[model samples]
Target: MRTDRELTPAELDAFGAELDALRERTLADLGAADARYIRRVRAAVRLCCTAGRVLLMFGWFPPTWLLGTLLLGLGKILENMELGHNVMHGQYDWMNDPELNGQRYEWDIVGPADFWRHTHNHLHHTYTNVIGRDDDIGYGLLRLFPEQRWKPFYRRQVLWATLQALLFQYAVAVQHVKLDKYFKGRISKDEVRPLQRQMNGKIVRQWAKDYLFFPLLALLIGANALAVLTGNLVANLLRNLWTFAVIFCGHFTEKAAVFPAEVLENESRGHWYLRQLRGSSNLEGGPLFHILTGNLSHQIEHHLYPDIPARRYAEMAREVRQIAARYGQEYNTGRMSRQIATVFRRIWVYRKPQAV
Candidate 1:
């Protein structure tokens, strides 16, 4: 068992080989079971959305509207997290179904799938928690890690963080546009122009689908358009809040590590695996919770083998924990509430300590 923080050259090569073998074995195990799981999830999402919208059309009744909105929210959350995130990760790419195609599927979110693929799959996955390299650390909004340095702006983080949670999807949508990069002259206006256009197109379609077209259709059916619209808004808010909570717990828990930029310089693959493991924390949850969070509750496993189908993460998690134990590494994880409390605690640490 290796106890070193940094891997020796031989150890690095050997560790990479071990991980590669694990990945291949896992891939070989993928089959109809994984394919059927995602297909059912996709079907459930569609059914829920269809039923929810139909119920909301009877919006004069409070119970019907509330239940409808809840269903709608659940469907949207599943579409983005379980279906879209996994699909776009190429988790079901082997199925070769065009609609389930990861490379081409567009999610029902404000963020363009293309941008998310680049920012999350390429940037976040590649860099993990390496500060300045992975934008996901604080997401350019709050100061989650002490090493991020203090500024007067962070004093308002309570407000910033709250608003961020409420408007989480939109915040994530704009993240890949590199507004800060352009301002700092790292990127130019021309580079962001095409991205801006793509965002605009997606935003228009999302707005039309959710707010305008649906509400207008409800009006045509003699339903209260206003109530239907309100229900939609409520559902979206709920989805946003839930997503923010789950994602925060996965990455910002107290035990999660944030790497320094210098430490990532010429980082070896073996060292990279260790960095990813330390940098990510997992949420302990049941099967339903895992499905809801797109199996990202097993964040440690996801970071280690992002290309693997997320549904496999739960089972893979057991083996991963064993591997970490053998290698004398901590596999950070805890109950969802505990992780979320730690996330909030991390946010408040800079200003004043909060008991987790």
Candidate 2:
């Protein structure tokens, strides 16, 4: 059923062994550099956010306002991508820093860390691209792959994808809600009430911080309250758009593969590794770009070694590519522009039933 060449049982064992050895080597090497790197990233996030807010207080000046918005957006991106996401992955837990504890760390996004742990950390990572299990397939909205059953609703997915990118955080926030199942009457409102309450509380807190609290603070200072509010709005919008693009490009690029439920049956470690390699794509970029992506630009490595500190992914990628080549598996990767274009094309092409 697979279009790509399959590894024999012995080859699969060797492939898994190689990857496991790489992971152990990386884990053993985690030390002061890794700790310092994450700490520095955290410091950068705070610096960007605070300085951006300070600049926004004088938003009467257009240049200051524009600079403030960009800086603030950059901070949120660093937090959402570099700091928050990786920390919540337990990537820095070995540092023994309570602040970096994955189970307890809360992110700046509207999605509760606990909810995300359930939907993303556990479910999405575990099921990955399995058709029925991974809700990330289209986030219960757009039809990104031909394997998904086509619906009349998907005709508008091109537009939906755009809006989803704009409001990406909100889409992530409500992912665990499974609204589609609720709408289909498979899950009752009573069953969803507890989760709804949790979702609403987080949404309100995030809104208050960005939309109300900061703007009100500016008003008290006799600054342009409207400017502050608008800046925050635009900043969140920037974060949404960028996060959406980086993430969509990672998983939905043209060559990325999806599998069925049965593949999980007695799936060997090597087979799981193979599935991760095939199902994920990487973005080619330099250090700054990689950091901004939480090193998820190395999506293949992240999928293979979910627990290893992501800061090491770039160097680790060289070995990973070689291993894939030796096993006759393609390591899906491309420049950001090329990958994202294919993702959009896939979205457009798969909106129809049996389009190919």
Candidate models: Cα lDDT each: 0.86, 0.92
Q: Number of backbone collisions per candidate, in order? A: 0, 0
Q: For residues 200-282, could you state the per-residue lDDT of candidate 1 as single tens digits?
A: 89989988988999899998988889888988888889989999998888778988888888877788888888888888889
**lDDT assessment of candidate 2:** 0.92
C-alpha root-mean-square deviation, candidate 1 = 2.7
Off by over 4 Å in 1: 1-14, 351-356
Compared with the true structure, model 2 gives a TM-score of 0.98
For all predicted structures, in order, the TM-scores are 0.94, 0.98
Q: What value does the lDDT take at residue 158 in candidate 1?
A: 82
